[model samples]
Target chain A: MNASSLPRWIDIGLLPVLNLIAALTVAGVIIAIIGENPFVAMGVMIKGAFVYDGALGYTLFYTTNFIFTGLAVAVAFHAMLFNIGGEGQAMIGGLGVGLVVLFLDSVLPPLLVVILAVPAAAAFGAVWGVIPGWLQARRGSHIVITTIMFNFIASSIMVWLLAGMLMAPGQMSPETRSFADGINLPLVYEVLQMAGFSVSRSPLNLSFVIALLACFGVWYLIWRTKLGYIIRATGHSERATIYAGHDPAKIIMLVMAISGALAGMMSLNEILGVQQRVILNFTSGYGFTGIAVALMGRNHPIGIVLASLLFGALYQGGAELDFEFQTITREMVLMIQGLIILFSGALAYLFMPAVVRIYSSLRKPTGSG
Target chain B: MADLWLQFVLTIDATLRVATPLILCAMAGLFSERSGIIDISLEGKMLMSAFAAASMAALTGSPLLGLAGGILVSVALSLIHGFACVTHKGNQVISGLAINILASGLTVTLGIALFAQGGQTPFLNKSERFTDIVLPFAEQAEHVPVLGTIYKEIISGHNLLVWVALFSVIVTGYVVFRTTFGLRLRAVGEKPEAVDSAGGSVSGLRFQAVIIAGVLCGIAGTYLSTAHGAGFIREMAAGKGYIALAALIFGKWRPVPALLACLMFGFMEALAARLQGVEIPVIGNISTDLILVLPYFLTVILLAGFIGKASPPRSIGVPYIKER
Candidate 1:
């Protein structure tokens, strides 16, 4: 039986769930190897992610970053491009956000500064991303290798600027001065309070709203727009796209720019909403995590949102697990993440033959009955 | 003038020391990529091997045991890469990325669990690590003039692993270009169907290439932990794997050119280390941070055809699906 002949639920929902279970099972074995009870750990993680006070807010805060980055990866995936430089793009985007707030917060209104910073961040990230895209399209450079190189270059650039010029006065750490007063996005707790609904304080902010908007925007752009058609066409077959008289190179560069812009928006959540300063390594492997989220989400906006929430829970819960267990640390989340990527992204179809076999056999018996 | 010459010599010496791992890794990448397997997980494998090497050395007080342990761990990872890319026919890049992430997380997690020192293994003493081996007549040559100074300062007193790195390049050059297996490996990368027609198992040959890569990366990782440094710290690979990948591209994926590229990057790093806080006549103080970006920046430029073209294996990154 053809694998694609499976039911929609099996293809889109059941398969991913099964893969997630496979990843979790492997993670459980690892936890056991480290002298911890996997079931107890899972319970603690669940409680920490949802049951604890203010945990949902923390999870949502993390979910916002993943949404931005997952969308970034998904957009590139539609164009058959892998923009792995999201970490660098986000860092540069934070720099743009920092520069704007630092220069304009006192001179201009806070809202105006933020309005300008969004495009500025996108533009900076686009420049970082489009260079590699252009190289891939025109110069025939491999996007993966160039993007990886660009990541290193971005890190070095960040270290240089932060340590030398951006370093706050009288501070030894490599970070910029905090943004001007009132420059922050509204925290979710405060927003809830304003609406007469009390909630515990967490880092969740108005950026979460922007992340949702971006998702809606991406869904519309990818599924409904003519440009999205061209991008998907280019991904399907560049030769066919060329036969249709569209310039695939231009499409590649444009899609990468958009992808980079989405990645760049992550800074709004981290820098403008939470940290309020451009700090060293603030992206903190979130860009890479975006790859897993995008893969597990199957590059759909709705799937990405759900996947982001799952990862957000894992991240929040993993922190709690670290505090509860002597052997397990926050790195345990990273291990689980790797396992998820392995099972979902790389070995996604490892169990497909068995699944198809079982599905066909069960369906045949039911149909005969 | 004498002092400046000594400084130059010392910088070259530093270049040799720093370039050893890059040389080894470039060779490893050469084997993997030439055989049509994209091995971006080179960093992950080396990092994991470094942790394993450090842990074993700390436990057993033997550098040899550490080297074996490192190689064993690295080969196991290479097998996983093989299973994903070859057996499952998965996205080669994603599989490599997954392994890299897995290694990065697993190393730190296991390190914390085993040693409880905040993701660091116990430091090794001289007996547990590969110390510098002084060449014969080093003291006698040091007393001689310019020629003697060059011999003693530039050539003598490197760890055993450094020589192994150099030797590995020669072996790689011979094995890649001269042997029948090398010819089959190259053929599989470029045209797997042709090799298939010739009754050669493409996957089998590719697996051998990845295993060779694994061994070289293992040696590189062991060199890092037991020879270059005392123990494993978190992320001890520190982008060296990526740099070596760049060097491989910069060298156009050949053994000798890749070694030279590694040396060039090593020289830049050595110069950066020496030039920190040193003011020049016009440029003033050149930031080491910018200098560190040179190799990556150069690779991008090279890839962009600003200098030369870097043509990879034709069938690279494409999974071979046997035609029905």
Candidate 2:
């Protein structure tokens, strides 16, 4: 069965849903192996992610980071680049944010400092990404290997800076001192309280708003811009892109820069919105998680947002599962995440032939063909 | 001078110990990548095997059983990679990445559930682990001069797996360059369509390559848990799989060169361990963290053609779909 002949809804919607189910089923089997009721765990996870007080905020807070990183991966995907350095880019972005806030908080207005810090993150991330991009473009280095190498290098750099120069004086932990009062992004509950409404506090902050805006911006840039067309063209066929008299190498670097910038913006949600300081390993594995989100979302902005929410819910609920069950730990979430990537990204088309056959049969009754 | 020689010999010994896993993994990667399959999941397979090996050794009190378990688990993973890439024509990198992530998470999750030791297996006793094998006459040779010192310090005292690692390299070199199967493997990787035209099964050869990779990685993982260390710790493979991949690229995907690359990296790590908190005369204190980054940095530089070109197989990363 030809995959292209499928309806758009089935292509985008049904396929992903089926893939997700397949992943969950595998995860369910693992849970059962560990002597837990999969259905009970699922119920617990849903309630913990959505039904509990303040859970929604925490889920959204996680979602904000995913959105930025997902968009980062999505942008690179359009250019046929697998930018796995989002983890490193985001870490460097946090460093950029940290430097700006640290230096300017005492001199500049808080708002100005915050505004400047935003671009600082993007610039740092772009620089981290561009080196690999440039290497791949000019030197014929494979971007995948270079990006993976950069992640390790980024990790080393972060450890060096945080433990040495960036470490807060008089403290043992490898983290920068907190930013000055009012320098941090406004938390969602705090904003709501200022507007005369009482709400439970969570880490969800204005970065969530920024993340939504980034989604819109990505949608506009990819669908409504010439650069998007060029990126997609390069991804579809670099030869065709060359035949069109445009430089695919330049497009690759530019797309990587954009991807890096999007990845960098994740620091806004993590550092500025939550931690208010640069910390060791602040990016966690969110950057890698973005790959799963992008693949599952099919590189679409709306799909990314939805995928990000699902992951966010999983993360928040996984934490709850860790707390509620004796055998279950947070690592189960990581396992589930791996299964999702396996199903949605690697074995993505495993069920496609079967789906195509079923759909064709339903559409054309009594047709042997 | 004698003291300095001793230090150097010890460092070389450490290099051998450290390079064992890297050499094994690089050889593993060589088999897979030379067959036009990009295997980034070497780390995951190694980690899972390490866990399996440690658990088996801990349970059965036999290193051989542990090695068997490790190989079994790794071969299973390799088959999955084959199923995805060969059967489903999925993205090879994604499959590798998923396996890696899954192994990482599953190891810890199972560790916690099974042992309740916070994702660590109980340390194996010497009886249950691969203890160092002192070479014959090493005690008598210890008192002799330079050659005897070299024999005792540099050549002796490594576990059986170190020898296995060295032997595996020789085997890999011969099999990859000297055999008909190797010729077919290289042909399939370079041009699967041509192989298909010649009535050879591209998928079958690729599957064989990955399975060979799995066996090598399994031995590497077993060496890690049972020989290099006493038992499995969470993320015990760490980034050795990646470092091995880098070494494979650095060596231009050849067995002997990849072994040399692994040794170089292992030497760097040994030197880093020695250099921790030690200030140099002119360069001042070199951070151990920075030293850890050197292998990756060098690989990137090498890949960028600062040193030499490292070309991969032409049909690498592209699944072979037979024309209807």
Query: Highest lDDT: which candidate?
Result: 2
For candidate 2, lDDT tens digit of each residue in A20-106?
999999999988987889999999999989999999999999999999999999999998999999999999999999999998899
Cα lDDT for residue B286, model 1?
A: 93
TM-scores of the candidates are 0.98, 0.98
Q: Docking category for candidate 1?
A: high
- Measured with C-alpha atoms, the lDDT of residue B268 in candidate 2 is 96
Two-chain DockQ for each candidate model: 0.82, 0.86
TM-score for candidate 1 (chain B): 0.98
Over A50-111, each residue of candidate 1 has an lDDT whose tens digit, in order, gives: 99999999999999999999999999999899888999888888888988888888899888
Write down the lDDT of every candidate, Cα atoms only.
0.92, 0.93
Report the lDDT tens digits of candidate 1 across residue range B222-289: 99999999999999999999999999999998999999999999999999999999998998989999
Model 2: what is its DockQ? 0.86
What candidate 2 gets wrong by more than 4 Å, as runs, is: A366-369
lDDT of 1 at B79: 91
Candidate 2, residue B305: the lDDT equals 96
